[model samples]
Target chain A: MASPRPRTYAEAREVSSSNSELGWWVFMRISGLLLVFLVFGHLWTNNIVIDPATIDYDYVASRLAQPGVRIYDTFLLFFAMLHGVNGLRYSIEDYTKRPGRRFWYKILLYTVSAIIFVLGTMTLWAFTYQEMGDAVRAIGATQ
Target chain B: MYRGREGQWAFLLHRVSGVAIALFLLLHVLDISLVMFGPDGPFDAFLAFYHNWPFRIGLLMVIAGVVYHALNGLRIILMDFTTWGVRYQRQLWYGVLGLTTAIGVPVLWIVVPQIVGGI
Candidate 1:
């Protein structure tokens, strides 16, 4: 079984076993700090400022049309995805007893997460939401 | 590892909340990405489905998890970095729980009514 999580900075450095592991240990702390703000802001805007029930395609589209929202979401997406994916990896290591199962589970997790990450990035940057709505409207009229 | 105690409970809750939030984050990204399919796509339909009372309740739980996880995560950070952090770890945990509940009440007050009215 893997060693217990280190409780102190010195213990973390000594018990890390490798530079990459130490790096991840540090990364978790840094990312977690940033996510507190990012996630709370996201939740406040989406869930509290407006009634979530009224959020539709147009609502999201209009929001994404702003450059500021795009930038904010990009940071939120990057940090949250990396932090969350790594957290899941830690859980897999903790719970998955069999080595074979653990290996396959991580592979599957990374692959799916990578694809989803790409899709999310594309959604943020690939097309203008305003044009997307207009294009759909034009297509509907033509039909 | 720490066995049964307040610290242990704190650790257990942190892990459970972390894992739960991580899974939700993955699904959240995937669903939100549906917007790429354009305005006429299944984005609204999928959102409508989730806006149902059951899913709204689930979303509330996710929010709860996030609040707890975030506060406890700060506790963990403190324990790792500061000298007094470990000495007062138990009290820090109580603070975490207290703060989570403090934030949770207002959140529920805002969300519960929305859920009820949506139904």
Candidate 2:
């Protein structure tokens, strides 16, 4: 079984076999604090300020077109992905019995998370959402 | 170890919610990234499929998970950082649950009708 998580910095230092593990313990608390606001703001805007059912391509395109939204979402994407992926790693370590299974599970998890992060970043930055929205609308107009 | 007490239950819920949210985050990112495929892409169709009531309910569950996880996360932070934290950990957990429900009630009030209307 995986060892118990540290309850304090002192305990962490005592129990942590390596600096990297200590760093992650610190990272989880720091990132978790930030994500509280980042995620709550995201949910409030997407779900409360507007009906999620009404959200579609045009809505997302218009939102993403704004520079502020892009920047905000970029931060959200990075922090949420890192915090979440690390949390999953903790779970994998706790639940998986076989060392080989644990290693492969983490490998698969990291691979998929990396791909999604790249995809999300590209979605935010690779093309101008305004132009993409207009281009799609233009196609619809003619057809 | 917290044994079979509230602290243990809090730890269990935190892990379950963390795993659920992480898995959902992966899928959520993938679907939102579909917007990169432009208007002609499957983004709209995929979103429409999610707009179904069942998925809408699932989204509610996600929101609940996010709320509880986020609040309890703060509780964990407090328990780690402050001298008074360990002393008050159990009381703090009760606070987390109370606040999660308080926040969730308003959220459900606002979102539930939208889901119902779409049906």
Candidate 3:
């Protein structure tokens, strides 16, 4: 074998990941900032824009009937839920130390979070103005 | 003194409060989405149940959760950008806490009594 060539053919070494914790941290900061606007806008409209007393089925029906409101509400649900879950995930990760136990704990955490996320989304989709109206009529019928 | 740093505390509170608020968001959205079914039906029933005292306070807690989550979140972002070193951390957390209280007071003023009165 010719003595190690000037252009040595060395095996490439893969670098390990660093700053994983820092990356999550940056995410929290960015997500938190966006939440200020989304969350506040949601409250201003729901609680402040219209009086809560006026918030009957018809009121919400009209709100969801609008494309803009629907989109906005969908966004609020999507981002806030995601942001919240990620934050919680970080919490569980930080606190649970043992590798095997931590793995199980994370699985549990994700399962619960996923359930809530699914149910919440389904609830949003089930929004039905006509259904609300009929349900109102049925309630009145009983009286 | 070895006080927990500001950015770290803010991070902690933001996480805790965010979870609380997020849970509330799920429930609140579920509650509001009921109106899509119209005002007169199960929607009213769903809301009417919360007219009691305990539920009202519970709702207020939700509001508090929102205040804590949002304000602390803002602090985290600011500290992320600015050079808020360890020494200044506790002060920053206190600052956020004050801001949260300031914002929360008015919300309580409006939301609490209404819930208490079964609104």
Candidate 4:
């Protein structure tokens, strides 16, 4: 027999805990709260405080050069990705009723999420502004 | 139970906002990653294009989505953890609406003029 649907959010939470959905539920709540602060702060800094017209390469490079900014951005990246991926996973499960299709869809979702997360992290930390500047200068010298 | 019209709207808004932000995050990640391509990269070019009027409108929507999602998410947490929260969920929902509007109005006031003024 199919399991009965949860009648309330509380019931849903209980069922989720018994199953494996509890972790994701808790994560969504926590990450959602954090993203509120992180994302809004980010918007305030980039879009409000700084002149959007002035946000060129130098501005971006200088902003990311700070270690504190990097750490804050890394945390934002990680939490946002995980929260979004899990939310999408839930949506996939809800939409895809068939077991086999659901399995494949989740696999694809996870793979893409992982790739995006890795790429974002690398972009945030793999290179310094000085390194990028030197590379640009070297390219210009080669011409 | 979702309980009322406001509760139902909150639920819907939360999901819709979550999905919208997720899609935005995908593009955001890709755009930021362009910085890795070096100083002479297409990143600045992309940002220039992204700063145009149309994209700014799109970003306004994103800000709206984030505001709703964040406030409603906090309401959900409050309901989950507090003793009398479930009993007062409807009130909390109203409070969330009030708070979102309070924050969103000033945000638009500050951001829209900047965008319309060209960047």
Candidate 5:
């Protein structure tokens, strides 16, 4: 399709502004770059080198015990959430154009994003491993 | 016809793939934690789980899911941000396939050698 003609001064604001579009452009570029490394490193560690064939509880626990792996994971956790949230935001923008809808959508997005971020952080950090597994295993067995 | 089934299929596949990967991630964490705890049997149990063909296919499907979810998300972002991107959504969808496959090849490269070695 051919590009649309330039908008008049008043018309420019009436149409979508480059300012907001530009913001998304910057976001896309930055997230895209971060995703490249975060994604590749995540894949390399998790899939390639780790050898899922040998992956088990202690393997993961020891890895997480390391300051480096923990730090790397926290970054992955943060960036994955950020990128996905930004994506959802853009999706809402695509389907809903009404101001009321957009406003409520943003509110909902922020709320849900916050809840997920909190939950993800909790799991990434405060996750109590083996807190219940052996207990359940014991209950399942007879003395 | 193309609009209806294709959109529905795309949405369904995206959801399916997402849930698949998320489940894998959850199980992965639990399995890792198990390794941390029992340190032996639990790890062995994980190996046992992989021996099942259904689980093997399910795992591959999870990789496919990640490929689709991440690429589809990119397509959506491009459509929203770029000036002419939406107009080229179909082309972009194909581009995602190309990109996903290209990146995915390396992953498959690793996967194939292992499967071959195992066979």
Candidate 6:
């Protein structure tokens, strides 16, 4: 058995440009830039501007209750998961030598990613502050 | 994979950090989503558990992963788009390392104290 030659940079780019690979490549760059801003802003808000010590269940509930916060989080969740999932797919493709193995690996990845996304959406949007009020109060009192 | 050149190492680190961050995001989304289940549900319990020193250290690691992944990701984007980027890829990798260290040290400094202080 002989080792296969790797594609040259130009060859790889040419192939990518002919298919959805180009779109994903471009997406990684654009989404990467967006995530830098979104994730940092999220961290700064949660960790830097507000004291980390104050981040209890009540704090999170209150924050999530606001439409603005939920919207921001939705975008964050969407972008982060998509970007990360795509990156992982790229890695799996690179490392998985067998076609059958790669097929199953991607099936698992996509299935899990989809489930997470759906669960995340439901968690973010399904409950109202009124519904959460008692629990929030209970948690806050304990803390 | 075997070579230890700066570019090679940077690429390897970027991939590893990216995967780690992604896995963490999965857990994060699932955990935070517990909020919708109920305000005082497992989510609150999880948040309380997150207050421990070990968890704080884990968070520090997450921060480190984010810092490196973001910077190196920027480098990768630049290399892909700019005309002269490939020519200077090595230099860019070095810049990524330098920036990661410069930013990472201060981040750890600020975060570690808060964690240790039981914040």
Give the DockQ (2 decimals) of all models.
Answer: 0.73, 0.71, 0.30, 0.56, 0.17, 0.51
In model 4 chain A, which range of ten residues has the least summed lDDT? A1-10
**lDDT of each residue in A34-139, candidate 2, tens digit only:** 9999999999899999998889988998898899999999999999999999999988887888999999999999999999999999889888866666776878
Error of 6 at B53 (Å): 1.4
User: What fraction of the genuine interface contacts, i.e. the true contacts, does candidate 1 reproduce?
Assistant: 0.73
Evaluate all candidate structures by whole-model CA lDDT and list the values in order.
0.90, 0.91, 0.64, 0.82, 0.62, 0.81
Question: Which residues of candidate 3, in runs, are more than 4 Å off?
Answer: A1-23, A49-54, A98-101, A118-128, A131-143, B1-12, B29-42, B84-87
Q: Tens digit of lDDT per residue, candidate 2, span B1-119?
A: 43688888898899888888998999999999889768778999999999999999988998899999999999999989888988898999999999999999989998889999999
What lDDT score is found at residue A57 in candidate 3?
57
Better of 3 and 4 by DockQ: 4
Model 2 alpha-carbon drift over 4 Å, by segment: A1-4, A130-143, B1-3
User: For model 6, how does the per-residue alpha-carbon lDDT over A4-81 read when each residue is reduced to its tens digit?
Assistant: 211334544666636577667667888999999999899889876765765766787888878999899999999999
Ten-residue stretch with the least lDDT total in model 6 chain A: A1-10
- What ranking emerges by DockQ with the best candidate at the front? 1, 2, 4, 6, 3, 5
Candidate scoring better on TM-score of 2 and 3? 2
Candidate 5's residue-wise lDDT over B67-97, tens digit each? 7777876765665557786678777777777
Candidate 2 interface RMSD value:
1.7
lDDT by residue (B16-69, candidate 4, tens digit) is 888888989988898888887677889999998888889878878887988888
Decide which is better by TM-score, 1 or 2: 1
Candidate 5 clashing pairs? A57-B32, A57-B34, A57-B35, A57-B36, A58-B35, A58-B36
- Encode model 3's per-residue lDDT on B1-112: one tens digit a residue: 4365555566666666766776676577567555544554478788766555676677667767787778766654554455553346577678778888888888777776
Query: Which numbered prediction scores highest in DockQ against the true structure?
Result: 1
The i-RMS of every model, in angstroms, reads: 1.4, 1.7, 9.2, 2.6, 6.7, 3.3
Candidates' RMSD to native: 2.4, 3.1, 9.4, 3.4, 7.7, 4.7
- Angstrom error of the Cα, residue A70, model 2: value is 0.9
Q: Which ranges in model 1 have alpha carbons more than 4 Å from their true place? A: A1-4, A130-143, B1-3
Candidate 1, residues A92-132, lDDT tens digits: the string is: 98899999999999999999999999988988988887676
Poorest 10 consecutive residues of model 3 chain B by lDDT? B78-87
